[model samples]
Target: MDTDYDVVVAGAGPVGLTLACELRLGGVSVLVVERLAEVDTTIKAGAINTPSAEAFYRRGLLPALAAVQEENLERISGFMAQRQGGRGGPVTMPPRFAGHFAGIPLKGRLLDASDPDFTGAGPAGDIGFIPQEPLERLLGGRAAELGAEVRRGVELTGFEADDEGVTVHAGGSAIRAGWLVGCDGGRSTVRKLGGFAFPGTDPSITGHQAMVEMEGAEALGKGWNRTPTGTYAHGPFPGRILTVEFDGPPADRDAPVTAGELQASLRHVSGTDVTVTAVHTATRFTDNARQAADYRSGRVLLAGDAAHVHSPFGGQGLNLGIGDAMNLGWKLAATVRGWAPEGLLDTYTAERHPIGAWVLEWTRAQVALMRPESHAQALREVVAEFSDTVAGTTFFAKKISGVWQRYDAMAAPGDHPLVGGSAPDLELADGSRLADHLHDGRALLLDLADAPAIRAAAEGYGDRVSVVTAAAPGRPELAGLLVRPDGFTAWAADTPAPTATDALGGALARWFGTRTALPTGPRAA
Candidate 1:
């Protein structure tokens, strides 16, 4: 079937844009369509986790993220000074805000940065507090620079898929592509029309998160507070407030949130007569957790909130969607380029579905601990106590920071511990890091001990994999490693043994296809 592009991505949010950038790097033609004419200025997702930050670092986008974080920190400092009545010396932020669990603050000073999972991560080890707006803009700009075509004000109204390709109808016009990915968010039209089954628990709480101007704002306490009605948190930034009420979902989820409505919820949760004077921006969310039965169906696929959605409790939504983009982008591009191994595209679902399911459960656990009753409050106290200790703090930090995430499906029999895990950003002899070599979005085979055998094993796939021979003095125990395009370690070698070379060959063939000319057609059925 003739196609206008290799992949047509629906949505111009961070996830879709990231996927487009990855595909462009893989030399695939992609088009991204967004219903809105401009980027949404929503104050969503105040931070990104470690894995998401590392993904950006590998693509050389960390500098952009750092700039955004600096601006956000300045704004936060200003808000703190305002709260302090601008009296004492300039109030500074804590050295690290290691994130929180169910509103329980995990002090960054208590976290052990020397943990094994954090090794070689460098500056990307820490979580970044970049709002959703700037993150989307950054990804959009990168996608554009990579030559991914983006059409704003074009909505995916419907689509039809066949064994050959998919015809996507957007903005009253039909466009053809080899694959269609729905990054269009929770209410994704592609997901519904593609017949993906969404199954999960319903929501029981309506939460309000907003930035506003309020009268008698001082009446509300700072930080997280639990009352008889529900829970409320005030002033990480002045007028930046959040309240959760055990009142099911909103009556009209799409209705615009008003000052009077927010004021009533604040009064009920804060137990104060605080009045909302003006709402600069506001959004309502719920604990409605759900996941698609599969991420792909024939020529159609889903990513980000299109595949799974949970509460914004742990700030995991944006990070999770970014993960989806990184995982799927290369695989789908390989398929479109006809160099993908058998069932390569299918692994997108196999490796990511479990992670999505786990995220759903993680958010549900937080919601369970946040109930307004005495039992949940008692449980919250015990959990908070556990979270304050060294071991407990480390555990929560690992989970919240996303360092513990490993793909069990990517593992082989008797694989090294590093296998199926994120590759450490090993520094080379010339002082360049592993991420520096990965900017081209190709698989990497790093030969730490100058082993000709390891390099020989990667010979056939030179077009798809880059071989780097560098001395990693910090990790002398290793001889070589095979890292996928997404920075996951596919194989690791302790010595330049023949058996290690054989394993490297197997991993290469498994991921990059056979040692022959690149196929010009689809995989043989």
Candidate 2:
């Protein structure tokens, strides 16, 4: 069949770019299109969660991200010193890694490397202050390096999908592809054009944020302002301000936000007449939560904000979108390559939709806890108490950091502990690591026991599944394991299964499609 590309990704943001990179790694031809001529730096998601960070590391992009974060740290320090009188006497600032949930800090102590629960979550280099702009640059550059065509200044005007392929109309040009994925923004035209059902709750509060010269920035202090009316926060820098008004969202949600409107909102929320001298950029957002009822509609699929959107309270939007791209990339590539087993592509929605719903609920819970009412205040106080304890703080850290997330490997195989979870970064006898083995975007039959039987079981899949005989002497709990392309564990055994060949054969067929040729020896050691 003649097609312009294997997949046409509508949107060139972080999610879209990451998806294009993954598809290319899987040997799929992809085209990424964005309406804007350049990357958008106005909206800042300043950090990534552990899983997204680890994904970048596995693809050999972490060192660049670490360099960007180091630069950002120095810039933040300088900004703070300049804003705070430049007095070098122990210039105290908030801890760089202390994240917040519902306006309360999830202290860095809980995320310490010593914690076993947090072990193997991600590389240490990824847990820093990397911002979104540099991340996009890295991802876009990597996608191009892997041979994905990215076309900016081209808008996806419309699309039509049939059984064979999808015809996308964009920028007065028509392009046919085997599939189309909408990684566009919250108000995605592709989503609307595909007739996907979006259902969710409306906004109960409005958030205003801006960088401006203010007269009384000092009184606002270094942290949050939880007043009787609303909440506001002035950061380590004087010009950066955030205000939350519990008033319902504005009538015109699409109206352009002005500095005047933000100033007014700031005064109302903070209950202070802080004079604003100048404004750089201002934007308004809402607590409105929504999700597409289905991620797939025929040949059209959705990811990122196009599939689900919620309050950015916990900074979960970007992380969620990244997870979606990674999860869908290999399955979609397998389908395009004519090797995907039955029901493999469908698992993308089944596995991810519930995770999307959980994030929406998480944000909703935060909104409720942040309400400026007596009951909400009492609840917040209780949660604050919990945050002060090790168990409570660790629980919150696990949830926020995404270290404890696990997907269900429905009807897959052995009920090993790591099933449906990310494969731990295991150290091998050769001093190499597990993630280092997966750089090529192929499933792994990691034979930790150096079991010849396991190697024999993986013989026929060839490049689709790589068998690795790594002596993971530290992880005595795992004799062998099967990990999917996206790093989630598919099956595991404490010892070789009684019927090793039959069991491994079932797993290979279920995940990587039937084998094409005789087995090559262990792809890596």
Candidate 3:
């Protein structure tokens, strides 16, 4: 049979499914092709980060996934670090990883665990983990519900593309689309076929994730406890423990690491001859460092591991992949509907490439510190208590939690309101949050009673922009906020100052372009 879609996405993993879901919501014809019959059971154990959650929230996927998770895990699981001079304790915990950048304000009291008001919700904060399989299934179902064509058991056999569109050859059939995205993971055929090269630093970490059903896990622990700097317990599940270690490396592709290999590692590390009766799921991996030289190549783009792979220090894998989907989804939709500047598509790479590299370099440093040499071990322990450099515990939590992702995307300090993380939850006069309002598929305008400027700033957006003047109670200084279709804060104006005024137009043109045409309604028909 032959099917032609607006976009054909390969590898129905979390990233691909997310892209499909968001595109389908925008009324874009999308297809997802996966060779596997079902989602895999092996878990990429970690919480879904705030930035990632925001990305999903933008697509209306977060609430559903959040409902399924065991609340949100918002604590920083400390890691040990070994130094060259002498391994000491983990570096000193800095203030809630306010940020690596010097001048950023301290957002958390790293030392004060009792600060109930404190929160770890930023690009660099803890994620909500509900297992990748369930997440993928949910995303797939959601995408299908939104009209994405999911073809399972369909292998990607070939592809041919030009400026006009992309034609995907899969499962002994032909599928065409305006664009093709490869979320297919490492060794992506689309990347290779598109001649996109992955050039970057070191190899990625090869580790296995196993759910150990300890008879008395609660008796042992609950959260990520210190098992020394070299290793740590991610968390003791109900009679279970999710673990990832720095193994040497996986063998060749023809010989992927198996359950038995993980079993051996468990026996060696845990010692005392503890028996691993069952393997929930086991896999091997390596090479913690790699990013595509760029994210785009003609009509084919890479997302998830397809575009970048790095040490899993931040639990960034799936989250980063989903972010890619969120970042590209609206842009793709606008382009297809004839509302976006062509250059906007290229910005995906410009915006995310540095982020990929930053995460990689940061993870590399963490890995270097995890070395188990005698002196290194001692230093890691001491530093855990004292050091205040980038290697400190405070920084580690913020870094890996993904709070450290500072983007040049928004140039001026106070320029664009949405420069940082997803838009903050602003309480409306009616108690509804600014976040809740934009859940409908639409571009949001947060009007801080600045009608003339808000409208003047937003007028060029045409019918494409649904202007909502958010009159934030009490804080009238918050003149306005621009909410992107994906739910991230694009522009926030505090009191409508002149310095930041120019940035409003810049921010709009950056993502949607000055010429973007909003749908007649929030939901694209």
Candidate 4:
């Protein structure tokens, strides 16, 4: 074992790299391990959500991802077919959900940013899907730039934790760290070695993925337009209709996927696959699974796929991982820097665990409807209707596009009028934008309403807080909302309230310290 680094993260996927970068920014000496000799180049996750985009944007890596693939998918819900006991049935789409069914959103998000509550504006906060490998390369470089020690061909064999920290085994040697995070995928050795229990339901069906250059399949529609046996997946990716088919049974991720097996399934699902000019790769996987019982054990933590596994039905697995890293990053950094409370570490599990379950709940319902059928007719009808519901459409759009992530579950206090809401681009007193002011990657309080309460709170704290006052209502969209650094609501107040100063001050003290928890301080001019 070697001397202790501040942190050690296993599995250098995008999530892992992001976590390491966040820790490095907090002055943590980090070591990142990956079993693969090189980064993966597959375009696995084709979509990026807003939270991930925002996180990457903060780190200046979104442009790299956007440069690689800039196809923008706006709406959400789509159809995925599954096979049941070798019985081929009708293609049934998950119900259209009429307008905006909350139930469907609980499934997979449809691809649209049509929600009224959603403000899709503010300096390009949108989701984009790119292949995972290249995405990691870009992020890994950024992580290394932030001082993370990235090591390829190294693997985390195991780890031992005590009251102080953890000693990680990787690269044929032992490495000590103040903390460890497992960002490895579903078949996580870190999860296994830590004796953590994965408590969630199993996937209903397995999926066979093939990056085949099929002859005549054209991605003609917005969603997965099917032809009996195959699905035409036209995404942000150029010149490729991601063609997929459901075959006999779901195989383990550890199991090998073959072009031959996928070719046969294409014939079964599409009814006439004809021939594959080139099978880039065929892989079998399932849509089932959820989170670990705990995200932290002693000094060891888990993020990304390591903490949760799910049917990629809504393209959520990667997004989920990204979200996990984001959720843990700031809190870990805050704790490391002494700004956060002792219980902040526990919030990672409490906050993110529910989100993991939420992903599973969304995917499980969506996967169930994607069952294999003799014909594609039934599936078409389902997509058509799902294309109509608020819940379903919002879910799909939010899931695939990454907007459905409402930060209500974030542990920051929510009683404030605008605490758990999204902050829009507002004009500051100097006419600069509120978002531009947040370039520091920290929590921001914009006194757009010019509420006396907020003015006084800032004065009371002095250098402890950086408060920006907007001259007038900035976007009209976020007129009364108090946004957080994570682009979520912290506490909101009526700007023109007579007792607004006292009310707002009390609200602020609740989350940021004594100031936000108790607002009895005198109002500043």
**For residues 1-525, what per-residue lDDT tens digits would candidate 2 score against the true structure?**
699999999999999999998899889899998999998866467678888887887777777888987787776777678666787765544443467878887766654545675777547424657677788988988999999999999999999899999999998999999999999989999999999999999988888777788787655655567787788877634477888888788778778877677778878878777778788766677888999998999889999999998888878999999999999999999999999999888999999999899999999999899898889989999998988877777777777778776788554544666778888888888887888888888888898887888888787787688888888878877788888888888777778766754676677888888777765557668
- In candidate 2, which residue ranges exceed 4 Å CA deviation? 79-85, 89-97, 110-113, 122-128, 236-238, 410-414, 497-502
For 275-379, candidate 3 gives per-residue lDDT tens digits of 555556545545458889989888888988899877665466777787788778877887877778658778678777877777667666656655555765576
* Candidate 1, run of 10 with poorest lDDT: 516-525
Better of 1 and 4 by TM-score: 1
lDDT of 1 by residue, 1-525 (tens): 689999999999999999999999999999999999999975688888889999999999988899999998888888788778788886768554376788788877787777786665777865478889999999999999999999999999999999999999999999999999999999999999999999999989999999999999888887778788888889677789999999788999899999988999999998898989999999999999999999999999999999998999888899999999999999999999998999999999999888889889989998888897889999999999999987788898788778888888888888778899999998888898999888999988898988889888877687888888888988999999999999999999899899989988889988999876532221110
- In candidate 2, residue 423 scores what lDDT? 85
Instruction: Give the count of colliding residue pairs in each prediction.
Output: 0, 1, 45, 66
Cα-based lDDT at residue 358, candidate 3: 74
Number of the top candidate by lDDT? Answer: 1
> Which candidate should be chosen as best, given TM-score against the real structure?
1
Rank the candidate models, highest lDDT first.
1, 2, 3, 4
TM-score of each: 0.97, 0.94, 0.80, 0.78
Q: How does residue 45 of candidate 1 score in lDDT?
A: 87
Clashes of 4: 66
| Residue 99 displacement (Å), model 4 | 16
